[model samples]
Each structure stands twice: as structure tokens, then as C-alpha cells.
Target: ARKGVAKSEQYEIRREEEEMRSQMSCHSLKKRAVLTTDSGNCTAEEASESEAENSSMDEGDDEEGSHEESEVEVLDEKGFRRTQEKKISNVKQTELKAVEDEEDDDVENLLKEEEEFEEKIDFSADTAGALKWKEDLTQKAAQVFLRQQQSTPNLRKLIYGTVVEDEDRE
Candidate 1:
């Protein structure tokens, strides 16, 4: 009886181990391989193969003639990308055609707008004279340097007295 009980416990432990092996955390599974199809990442070869499969599926769906928006997610060596396409029905197609016809009338207004943008690239002479302050840049900088030098007292020289500066170390 004791031996049978031990055997049953051992069998239960083995079953638990098998279950743990089969079930894995998402993080561990994804990190197992960089380009494994199981983890939603694929190498270039797998990417092309999947694309071919998608194309065949798309060809079959063409017969259904459903105008629903479709989204496709492509996973490849570079990265993952999702693109969506909306299929236009006859009504939307006619709307687009009408918009294009309206745009034809707006082309002349767009050309006229070009003239407005072309004006005033060179400012009026009135504003040009306002830049007279910037004319003597070098002289202004020199004047500012001298003024600051005269205004801020040299605290070090003032503390030590001028005798140190007046002294000829030579």
C-alpha cells in the first residue's frame, strides 16, 4: 500500500512537469528565437512565403466582391508593419470623381495664389532703413566692450590695491 501511494504521487509530479513544459509565459516564448514564426517574428524567407500565401488568399477573396476595409500585418526581418486599405464602392468612386472635377476649377485660383506669395520677398524700402542700427556692427561691439570694462570695477585689483599692478616684477 505504501509503495502504491508513492508511485501515484510520482506519476502526478510527472504530469505536472509535462504541463509546465507545454505552457510558457509570453515573454519567454518571444525571447526564445528572434525570427521564429511561432513568436510572430519571421526571417526574410518566411516573410516572402507568407506574402505569397496572402496573395493567393486575396485572389480568392476577389470573387466575393465585398467592399470592406482590409488590414494586413506584415512581419519581416526589419520589423512589423500594418497597412489598411479601404475599398470604395460605386457611390464613393463617384464622389471622388466629383471632387476631381471641382479641383479643375480651383487650378486657376491656385495659380493666382502664386502671385501673392511671390510679392514682398524683398521688403519695402521703409523697413530696409530700420536696419540702419545694424550697419556698424564691429564699432558697436567695440564700444560695448569698452563701456562694460569701464563700468564693472575690478574687485581683485581694488582689494589688493593698485601697488601690485603698478609694481614692475621685472
Candidate 2:
């Protein structure tokens, strides 16, 4: 019991450290940066469209080996939303020293890429006059997809009904 409690405590510490790292990385975006996307609000139709896209992609894609990163959007403290690709690498490979080195390099490269993206989105100077909202469509889609998933409690009500949910409620 003592060993088990110690292990669980260590696991929680690790989780908190990872959360802090994610927060720092996500918050690095500049406030004054004029993001290319002007996404005002997410709607039901938009959510459905994202669901359809996700469903179709799920059906046709069984080759999980080919995909390394899955896109997810994290909202910062300032409510600035930016899309990031979350690495879903296999845990079996975690022991590899080469993979560790590669991941370190990848983190550095990812930071550089984010900086470049922020720079690209900043159109505060003005020049072409035509604003490009099309560039961040995929990011918008990812956000919509996340929104739908986050509403899973509503889905639970529809599927399991209030009866089952009520019994489980604290």
C-alpha cells in the first residue's frame, strides 16, 4: 500500500509538470499579433460539418502507423486560441534514447514553427488589403471538433437518459 501510494503521488507530480510545460508553450503567442483567422463563433451546423469530416476520416483511415500527430486547439489565459498538433507516439518507444533526442529537437522545431506562424498571421502593417481567412480553416475545424467532444455530457443524456446519469451523480 505504501509503494502504491508513492507511485501514484509521483504520477500526479509528473502530470502537473506536463501541464505546466503545455501551458508555457501555448502562452508564448504574442497578444498584438493579428491572427489571420477572424472566427467569431462556432455554430451547430459547423459542429455537424466537423463531425462528418471526422467520421469520414475515421472510416477510411485504418493506417494509424502513418499519422504521428493529431491536431488539437488549446485556449490560453488571454482567450487566444491556436491550433497545435499533439504527438501521439507509441509508449513502447519511450525507452529509446534516440527517440528522446529526436523529441527534444522536435520541441525546439515546434516552438520555431509557432513563432513563424504568428509572424505570418500578423498583418498589422497592411499591404495586400485583402484579408485571408481561408488559411486557418483547418484550425477552425479542429476547434469545432473539440467543442462537440466537450459537450459529451449532452450526448450522455441523449444516449443513457437522465435515469442512469442521475443514479451515478454525486
> What local distance difference test score does each model get?
0.36, 0.37
Query: Which prediction has the highest TM-score against the true structure?
Result: 2
- Residue 42's C-alpha lDDT in candidate 2? 19
Q: Mind giving the per-residue lDDT tens digits that candidate 1 earns over 51-143? A: 233333334453223211111121121222111112222213333444455553354344234322421221221124323433654455455
Tens-digit lDDT string for candidate 2 (92-142)? 122132235555556445444543454233222111222234445455545
Q: Which ten residues in a row have the lowest lDDT in candidate 2?
A: 66-75
Q: What shift in Å separates residue 149 of candidate 2 from its native position after superposition?
A: 29
Please give each candidate's TM-score.
Answer: 0.20, 0.22
